[model samples]
Target: MDQSCDRTRNSLSQSPTPPLVGVETGPASEFTGKYMVLLRDGEMKEGLQAIKRVASLTSVCVAADYEGAAVRMDEAGKAEVFVLDKLGVAVVSADPPQLRRLQSAAAEGGAILAVEPERIMYAIEPARDRLAILDYLRGYRDAVNRLYDSLTGVPGEAEKELAALTAFTDNAEFTWGVQATRVNQSRFSGRGVRVAVLDTGFDLDHPDFVGRPVVSHSFVHVQTIEDVHDHGTHCIGTALGAQQLAGGVRRYGCAFGGDIYVGKVLSNQGSGADSAILAGINWAITNSCRVISMSLGARVQPGGAFSSIYENVAQRALTSNPGALIIAAAGNDSNRPIVIAPVSRPANCPSILAVAALDSNLGIARFSNGGINPNGGGVDVAGQGVSVFSSVPDSFPAWDQPGGPGRPWPPRYHTISGTSMATPHVAGIAAMWLEARGAGTTAQGLWQLLTGSAVRLLLPSRDVGAGLVQGPV
Candidate 1:
């Protein structure tokens, strides 16, 4: 017998195929000729052997080296194989007959868990119109400053303290979501909690995070851990930035003392493959992180079910890590009063908490995704997202752009909108709750406590779920 044949036999003999859950059997319409096969955790070797076996049965060409891994390709580039061992998943492009055979092999081999179509994931933020938004915010800030100056009469240390407090409270950094959740009153600071933020990576040398404990990795092979795009850094800042900036100008973060785990799942372009996101989740679970924050997702049609791979991974992480919770953005694809988009993928997974975005007035953000599914996956909570301020990379050009004609340019501290901003607020708040609740609490229990404590609003459940997520009370 050939060596490859021997390996295939060994792989099939290892274990029996597990039941497929939440996975569609046939090829998806979006992925008519391609599918992704996910293996059980730590079973990459067996999975690869199974894949090779399936390829040998078809007319596919199996190449030993395709970007540091093996690939199976058919002519016309319509069929290809991407073996993502780090994610325990393999992406295969094949015709209907080939896909069915692969699925059959996967089911019999046991090493393959799910065979679903590949999906795209992206950072959940609106296209940057920050320059215009910054100008409007600057005007508002000037007005507030003028009011503050007019109100100050007594000149003393007490007056200065009051001034500082006013400035802090008035800024976008001190968003209404922060005030509404009452995080300021909580004594807990997520001191020992480890939070994994899976996004477009972070600025490793950001001055604000100088002394903080940060561990970072890059799943996007082309990019390093350094964040060229500011999305990841902004989200991390909201979740784990310092309590105060250098001059005590603002109070922007929630879990000030939480350990930061930055996973660059998305590339600098702010888009990523499903395999990369899954790999990031695996990394977070392996690292024993208490909270995994994903401000990224792929839009799915209404009534679409969650991905089995992500759902299973989230369930495992919850059971394995003490109080480990995965929080994700609901996405920024809605146009209220017109079109209302459903919660995005991964976030739509029941095991993951889906967070919506709310403005200062407590209304749902125009772009915040809704709970259209009505079954399992829906918006679980709300957070401040509109005109929200947080830390950004000092080198980001948007920060230096002049606000309109005469208005001052936005500072290193930045403000933006989207469910991307809201997600970290919830992640940081979850960290605070985890800290207050102490140990032995399960992820589901923390989720209940967080949702149960939410300040109910008048918005529909489809829009805000249990309402604004609260901090430790």
Candidate 2:
């Protein structure tokens, strides 16, 4: 065989299909090159005797009481096919999370074999070799493998920045039944809510956020999927950052933790036009994101009315099934030549919620958008925006750099001010609201309920809309 062919064959030799390990398309045996049975019966001797009767093999390694070895082997790039005892109580009633971890580890390596509960005897008893090869090839690079995964990015590769969560004990002053967590703690801890914030980007490596699994994508011509503008992650930290990180604490950030999706719609300059936001909105909807928070906006809408991409997409995005709630920043530019786009454009559209900024003291942010909406319903609600602390990417202008001209690595975190900061708090609260309404609530309902439930701050109803948000009541 040629060099390339030889390399391809070698990659497959490492799989763990056990003849019928993956998605069941056909009979198991026409697959597995070899297989083993992890007996479920109580009598170890009887299980071994069964294995002996079933095979011509001489040696055997006992399956861990918890499948730890199988999991570890797969993680370490060894052990192809495995027969998990279907009869053992512990094995049958295995912990779902541990099992999922094992599965994940296997997928990472491209080799893993798991027998159906007590049915190892059934799935593999007939044929094992083909299954083994399948498991091996799943992790290995072979001609048969073809998928949407990025072929350019190496598997298990590391990113430019590693997020670290610094935990702190809450000083009584920092406590106040925060909008998102208070509700989440009382009710929905975002159990399974998949919140995709299409703003900046997330600190994919942060400890509090590690569990949710961040899927990042960049839309602007200048940025890549690893976009770390810090806008998106800060928004994310407010919505789903884990509280009380084990053995430590983070003063502010993270809404008690849940799944977070990062759809970067803005450019590194932190400015995004309609097209990018539209692409991000469409992608989030296509990905079935329940709540999408957009804290970034542009100043010039010189294009015709529908020409404003953010508004157009917001209107069209509302038309999808189950739909998605699009939350936007009401701009920090105070009333002026064109203070900010009226809610009607983006927030004013069908299902959008245009949010203004509020300070921790619960008042309109001094620099927030205002004046009056010549045509309209109330403006929108407010959330904690002033003096907020959040993640800053290595490239954010807020940070000072060293080595690479202006760009730096291993960034130092900083806090900045903007309605951009306040918008996320509202977005996070909206997500918690979605969780409270249960599975029946759609993205549209989330926006309406949020608008309706707002506490109506002192500002003119048009300035603050329904008012300030209160924890889910």
Candidate 3:
């Protein structure tokens, strides 16, 4: 396998240069004024030189010179070009005429591969009312557990005794999500695999993950890997939480044995830009992580085209040796029985896996986006999302408090819904499959096993591409 950045060096060698479309602009297309530039593999120096010449760029900032990919964007923003060396990509701030010059260079088969406007993205926010339904489900579940305990044994002892019987049942020992995916029955624990979760930073002090191996870095300018927002902590909990949990907390994660990689691409306010996301992807690939789970994306219009730069990067990741499979959330923009939105960006790229959300009854989530558009915008798989139980920062407020209680414990756990919650389930299960399939499996091979082995549902393929993803037996 070629180790150089020019994984697609042959893209221009044997063919005529494709017609250039330059940068797109309009009211519907929301982008930062800056542009993203893809450099041909192995021609980074030439690309930089071309950019300097075409755009008359005077200042440049290269990521290779920084520590932990923490390039000071404040300083970088002042430069005419900011280069992500590992990914062979750059963010350029230039005038429209200068951008046209770069496009002309690309059309002439120069080192510049592609140019597009940088996009704005966010951590997929669940529908405003989705959490209300999740809260109701949690209440019903607790009532059932309380009734079952009172009718059978001591108030709390039922959970401990029946924990052994939780393999296929949703109870106090295992979340409905764990039972739905059947991860509880799988023997593989994802040992020796590397799983990267890119979102808001994580709660490094969370007690549930006290002893786990974690490598964390932040691409968000000036932000550390510490998850100030609860979203990243919750997502990581579902993908890599401990199996042998203390305090009788139900099992929520899959791939408990996989090495954890945390990439903080989104900010504490649950928003981010394309440059941060691309940098995070580069860092994950550089580390050879086998699974890169992103629960963030920008909303796309019904017929919006996917980013060519992202598509190319994802393809290279799949083809590279010791490659990584990137999974992302389908947007939660639908109203169900009313309106259905297209899948979100980045995930809409053909090479990335788009994940939809499923409720406890194995029904498509009302807010889960679908395949309303063509060209790789379909939802590839479904996972448990409604009323999901997962870890959160200890200081985080519980989603539900007891009705007439004296005072419940400061629950270090939470239950929520969204495609954001669903994506990690697919990612964690992918890690388990990699462990089960053996060291010889490529990223493409893992993708095949995932969709091929999915439990087909009656839902339209648009809503659930191959149906729900399942753990390997």
Candidate 4:
């Protein structure tokens, strides 16, 4: 949803096909030949030892070779061979026969609970032509600025005129989604709630969020927590930006008082593997975040089942303290006028809440993916996505002129359209509901509250699910 399509497009085209359930394959199968073994809670040390023993017998180097291995501390704060102890999962490279032997040993020793093949996942592409629209807006703003500057010879007059124009744009009414969902009328501000947004990353220096408490972590090894790609910043802003900008104008944020947790699952190029996303989820769960919002995913073919590993992880997170509810974008692969795409991976997982995109007119966005899969694998709700206005990094590169100084006119907000944009609206609304429900609320209860409270719109169940998500009264 970052408007950068090169990497994502290639990923989509070359993505590996998922294996069928209970299907037997040879060592030369297209599968990655790598398996993620999930250890039982409180059995990480035993699991590691068992894995090391298997490696020794098989003559394969342990993934956790202390000298030059991929070393990272575990959740227990101990420097371990694998980096996913908190999630109780370990990545091991092995062929079918080797994996079976490892599984047998793990089961016999009570080291691992389950084993699953590591699958490839790509970031969902956003609505097309968004960058062009942004550029047009920037040009219009520059024109307005030049005209204002040329007309006003006196400093005081120029200042007064600029203030008036800023006020006009700032004092605009609530966004259509906010008004349609009646979030503007909600008294609850999601105070004392921690919401984790797993995406590209965030703009550490964005002025609009300057003093807001944000706990951040980077799961993508190549990238830091700094959001060079604007997708994560835009999603985070909609979820937890300040009610008022630095200039005391524009009331855009929904959960103004909610605690923010930024997890960089995707790399700076707006692409990442499933391992990084799984790690981000583990981190969010470890932090006890009440709601985890994911605005990225990979497209799924019709009849494709959800990822069992993600579903299991989400179920575990739901049973954690205060419970963590995952809300994800349904994807932007649909063409309402022609073909309708099914819900994507991660979101297609039944335990996760899949959100679709709605326009200002209460119509389903043409690019919003549909709920083609039956049972629990469709969209659960809708949110505002088209022409959505939210915060972006002050120094975002896309906003800069081709040959001009690095800085284009400084901007605190941007407009984008995608199910990715729609996801945070639901996330923020969920936070408000949590705040109103007070303590001792579970993830399933929050999901019910959200769907039951949604306003029924005149759209297909496949397109809009339970309808548009609403805020607490």
| Candidate whose TM-score is highest | 3
> What range of 10 consecutive residues in model 2 has the weakest lDDT sum?
1-10
The stretch of ten residues in a row with the least summed lDDT in candidate 1 is 1-10
User: On a 0 to 1 TM-score scale, where does candidate 4 land against the true structure?
Assistant: 0.76
360: Cα error in model 1, Å: 0.7
- Deviating ranges (above 4 Å) for candidate 3: 1-29, 67-75, 124-127, 130-169, 398-410
> Per-residue lDDT of 20-64 in model 3, one digit per residue for the tens?
100111225467799999888778899999999999997998887
Candidate 1 lDDT, 1-473, residue by residue in tens: 00010001011112111110011111222333456787777777777777767765332322223332212222212336555554466667667777777778767758877788766666733233433244335435644664566567435544443433332133535655567678777788888888999988998887778888788777786578788777789899889988766635467788998999998887786776675676566667666678899987776777788888778767766665364799998877676748898788888988899999876656676667888886567989998777666776666653434453221324455556678888999999988888898866778888887799987776799899898888895
Q: Give the whole-model CA lDDT for all candidates, comma-separated.
A: 0.69, 0.46, 0.77, 0.69
Q: What is the lDDT of residue 11 in candidate 3?
A: 21
TM-score of each: 0.75, 0.55, 0.83, 0.76
- Runs of candidate 4 exceeding 4 Å displacement: 1-33, 39-83, 100-114, 124-127, 130-171, 247-249, 401-410
Give the per-residue lDDT digits (tens) of candidate 4, residues 295-381.
877666778778766777777676666678999988877666577878877788888999998765566776788888774568889
Q: What ranking of all candidate models by TM-score puts the best one first? A: 3, 4, 1, 2
Clashes of each: 0, 40, 1, 0
Candidate 4 residue 121 C-alpha distance from true site, Å: 3.3
After TM-score superposition, what is the CA distance of residue 318 in candidate 4 from its true location, in Å? 1.8
Candidate 3 overall lDDT versus native: 0.77
Candidate 2 lDDT for residue 217: 68
- Candidate 1, clashing residue pairs? none
Instruction: Look at candidate 3 and tell me the lDDT of residue 28.
Output: 54
